[model samples]
Target: MLAAMRTFELSPADRFTFAQRAAVLSAAYADYFVPLWVNAQQMEAMDQIYDVDARRSVVAHAGREPIGMALLSLRGPRGWISAVGVIPAWRRRGAARAMLRRLLENAAQLGLDEVWLEVIEENAPAAALYRELGFSAARELLTWRYPADGDLLPIPRELLQPAPVERALAHFAAWHGQPPSWQREEPTLRHLAARSSAYELWMEDALAGYCVVGERPDAISILDIGLNPDFGPVKAGRTLLQALAHRFRGRAFTMINVPADDDLSRALAALRFTVTIRQWEMRLPIIAR
Candidate 1:
């Protein structure tokens, strides 16, 4: 006989079990284009920020075996659903749909007016599921990366200085044309402030642009970069890239997520950044009844 599946809210006190379930789902969902793994440290950080009342975990059980799981996080007004997966053997049993429905209900109860998520471009099943739930295509995001070969540009290094937090925040606020839900706002700024280093590019003693680089064990991730839209994309991007490379010589970089169609994307491509994968940013607007 099979036990009934259950949905529940995971509190901070349930850290141990939460971590275990998160790891299991991450492993089961890891695919060629969608790498959804999270380490213990990252999980701890997530638990700290994700509102327990808004977050949920659904587990489908048959007998004593766990067959499927899903996780959601509420960041400010946005509810983010991530790491939804069913073990290969247990797929096609409606577990995914049940988990998603429960998550959406939880999001509504939490007073979130919107929900957002990302699906790998190649994941048709996941994309279809989101579409059925009223998620529409917002934009396409890409991850670009380049190897660090100790190559250095001849640009003067004096023009670059460490970015000040206040200035970086102001600059990010002024950035336009990015999706409302996709903008790197307070939380992202806070994360960047703690885990990354920034550099300000100066031309004639004026701020031309700025870039933030986040260092990880495997690669240096370019978290954010903004240039004066007037400077022309190619020149501005090259200047930022050269400055970044000079700052961290001999270190490889992997831009985890960036706009697929942005001017910066073209510049990075010109400098030999290969497209690793593409993802569709999906948005669901919670209409008031």
Candidate 2:
């Protein structure tokens, strides 16, 4: 099986065909959660200058037919397993494992300190596979579908004024609280700067909390939110959330990858947020060969 799998490093933006990539993703995730449908706009967005380096995306071909792929996002000492897929016909033939192994070897060669990925909490088989490959459970992340209407009474606009993107980004950089998953991490936020809107919550002259939300088309994705660790996560989360709730009144939203045990979860619970799904962030440390 391994002999039939010819691996090729793909520079997706330059050489690989999008339709082929999309086909593999769809087939691999046939029974998986929300199978990917890579639309034209999404493809254009992917081509934009994000932290992702196309050369790290690997494709496995069985006699010129793409059967598996693994997408990587490089961030200096940190690397992310953004995606991994194996078509239905390739499953159980060791295609997924082979593709992953090749990616890991290449990641190590790139001198990354650690490589990380997230798996659905209920996916026992995938989790076990990752553990066997040296990945360890790091933290539980929650995906919440929050539709609760917050206090309708208006608050001081000054308290939740628009903040400088750099200011919010700096606060994000300085945060020492719960470790964030890929979507909420600094690299993703930095890459999304231009399209995301930023805001900071304040108490008098002190900055208490901040958030970055996706604008327009995807107004529901709360990309990142945080507060001063010393100020208290629960209080700040509520305050910040309240501001957001009022700002986006009657509009529904979904937040992803929030630490399950953190104070923010308590705040979310108080707001009647429902857990849509849960995921586990897995980490693997690397030593160059």
Candidate 3:
């Protein structure tokens, strides 16, 4: 007979070590071969963005061996499902369902207004599970990427002047044609301030386009870029991509979760950036029970 499954919360005293947590996630995603895997340090950095609470993140065990886990983030009334996974050996068990139900209950208890997450567009089973749990499609997000080919030199830096990081961040929020997806929100960029910077190219001192980039130990990630929507996407897109390529030339970068059909997306494509991945942002309104 299979051992009885039980769950427990993470804690500040470090009841569950970071290595242990990383191991569970790595095993849960062991079959995936692309983009390498997330290490303990990377997980730590990511957890900070969600304001992860140990008491709220759940770990499941079948007789002391971890079989599944659900990591949650609580920011005000917004609860984000940062990640959820079950080890291969434990697949088809009810652990994922049980853990999510527990997580939603926890969120409701805290009086959260809503919960959110992203599911890969091709992951049908996972999407179905989230849908069954009351998640609705919020928006489609796309990841655009390009290798900084040494052969492709950037235009002179004089063409794109470095902008004040703080001021530009503010301008980005003000210029958004639509509300930004959670990962691309200003708060995320600010929280990651230690390793990030922003730049702007002006059409005579007013903002033409601007981009934010962050440098982690292992990844040089593009957070987001904002261009004047009034100028039209193709033109704004061209200017922004060229300016970005010039600024961060020779170093491959991946921009995460930009609106799929917007001007930015078109610009990335026109610049030959490839779609590395796509995800559906899903949301759940937490009605207190």
Candidate 2 residue-wise lDDT, 124-193, digit = tens: 8889888888999998999987664534534435457787676798977666377677777786787788
Candidate 3's C-alpha runs over 4 A off are 1-14, 33-36, 150-158, 216-219
> What's the TM-score of each model vs. the native?
0.81, 0.85, 0.86
**Which candidate order results from sorting by TM-score in descending order?**
3, 2, 1
Model 3 C-alpha lDDT versus the unseen true structure: 0.74
Q: Candidate 2 lDDT (Cα, whole model)? A: 0.74
Q: Give the runs in model 1 whose Cα sits over 4 Å from its true position.
A: 1-16, 49-54, 57-66, 150-159, 180-184, 216-218, 230-234
164, model 3: CA deviation in Å?
A: 4.1
Sequence-dependent TM-score of model 2: 0.85
Residue pairs of candidate 1 with colliding backbone atoms: none
**Candidate with better TM-score, 2 vs 3:** 3
Window of ten residues with lowest summed lDDT in model 3 = 5-14
lDDT of 3 by residue, 1-289 (tens): 2334334333221356676777777877777423236678876777787577767888876654567678888878898887788887677778788788888888888899999999888888889999999999988988988876634534533366776678678777657777777787777777866677877767656677777788654445888777776667577657766766666656787988887877678777877888988899999999733
Candidate 1 C-alpha RMSD relative to the actual structure: 3.8
- Candidate 3's displacement at residue 252, Å, is 1.8
RMSD of each: 3.8, 3.8, 3.3
